[model samples]
Target: MSTPLTVVCWNFENNGKGRPDLRAAGADLLRRLAPDIALRQELWDADAHGHKIFNEQTRALGLQGVLGAESCTAVFYNPAKFSVVRGWAQGRGPHFVLPPTALTLRYEDAGPDSLPFNAVSYHLNYASAEQRLLEAEWLTTWADKGWTTPGRSHHTLPAILAGDNNSYPTSSPGDLPLPDLNTVKNEPHRLHRSYAGPSGARLPDTRPDTAFRTAGLKDAALYWATAPHGDPSALSRTVNASHTHGPDSRVDRAYLTPELLAALTGFEVIEVDEALSDHHILRLTLNGDLLSDVLAPSMSA
Candidate 1:
């Protein structure tokens, strides 16, 4: 018998913008949520003080992890659930968080020869649809047999990418209505999430999410809500709707390839007291029986 694998993605408004950095609080919340994997963004100075901040946080969460080192993103996994393989960061800064990071790990109890999979933490450009499209293009490469990293070996492991995508998901028409471009409060969403149409009309650009889905990956929330055995109530926004801080939208997401999708068992948009983070948490659960099966293909190979 195998246990469930729980994963979470959060943009915890790091770096104290007119507010104090709640690194401690955020980790405590993650610990309570008890995800087997956690993806984080916007650590502001995550590598500050010789990585004191990040190290302390991960310690509190009881997970071993890796930092993008150059960007403000990180991927941490439960050491007991999987053994660490190698972690790497890709892309250049001034585009996305710390260049987007990934961690590879093979499941525990699997023999040394067992194949490992990867989990990625990424944050797309918040200012340009074109840039976001480019980011998605880079990410879609994972659906193929391998993804090339400039300075590393070809990464061929099955992987999942999750984080603050920052734009609405184009793959699914989520339960919330599209942001109103006409409203003054929605200017950011309009300017960032929409593309100019033929007659200068603003149309929501979904190329980012669409590219991932088109690459044959499943958007976890959408898949969970729509799958026959999934809970329909799980369909909702990833950001807190009641707050006027930004447009009500589901900007955070997790995308899984066929093997991981097959193991997916549960999904949730965890609403936390914003005193801890700006965005809600997205938690996904996968059946370890199915996950462990895919990680060891030699038996069938």
Candidate 2:
């Protein structure tokens, strides 16, 4: 059996310029996913120039996690399930003062195997295409570096790269030269659905097809199809044009290395329509045994 891991990424869209309750709202959105780990973008903290909110809300919601980077880009993991091994942040200078923006994480699960996994959460600058390319280069370079741990040349643990990339996959139109706009002018056709299948089941299958071969690192990431709305039968928020800004776009994404992808049993993305922020959450599940592979350098690359 594959390890069962639920991972998600979301753009809270709260740049500290909106309503005061956004913090609470962001926390509420996470509450719905119940994910083992979560990566968030556009999150502001009291330390940043415009950020007035701290992680108080996230803490209040039982997701009390912290990273060295500022609040704009952050990671939250369940202490009950995993332990942090190593973490760092990138994109911190004034020239690129959006937020720390990128994070590299190494975590160990609580299971007997003590398997480890490396994951990163990043938010790119919403500037011109040229600028985005520079950021994308940085991410690709980092991914290429792989992960290293004590007594291990590389942590082969399944590596996951997730967050509000801001860069659309090749399947979508990333060629457009517009960066000022927050939404994509030509979104991929796959995002049109309001939810997943009737049973709310889909697997991670963002394989590289002819059309997606050159989409950069995004092509390296796979999206797990999931049920659109949570607990469809339960009382939840309804997602529509006005609320989520244009027919709900699944801009947030999660990716795993091909080796890691094969090790997992299932992965899924959740459409948390109304938990806190406008964006929906994503989830991924992996086989617990495969985690052991991560500890071996031969498996990490």
Best by TM-score: 1
lDDT of 1 at 118: 72
Reference-based TM-score of each model? 0.87, 0.63
Off by over 4 Å in 2: 1-3, 15-20, 46-52, 67-70, 90-97, 100-106, 110-116, 146-158, 172-250, 272-276, 294-301
Candidate 1 lands at a TM-score of 0.87
Candidate 1 error regions (>4 Å): 15-21, 90-98, 145-156, 171-174, 184-189, 242-247, 298-301
Q: Write the per-residue lDDT of candidate 2 for residues 1-301, one digit (tens) a residue.
A: 4456666667666632466676665566567667777776776544555333545645654664554355667677777667775554533333333443333334454333343555667665543333444444444443444445444455434456666544344333322121222242333322321113348652112221211233233322232222232222111111223323333333455556556654455544455445355555555665656655654455444
Best model number under lDDT? 1
Cα misplacement distance, residue 270 of candidate 2 (Å):
2.9
TM-score of decoy 2: 0.63
**Alpha-carbon RMSD to native, per candidate:** 4.0, 9.6
Q: What is the lDDT for 20 in model 1?
A: 33
> lDDT of each structure?
0.74, 0.48
Model 2 / residue 254 / CA error / Å: 2.0
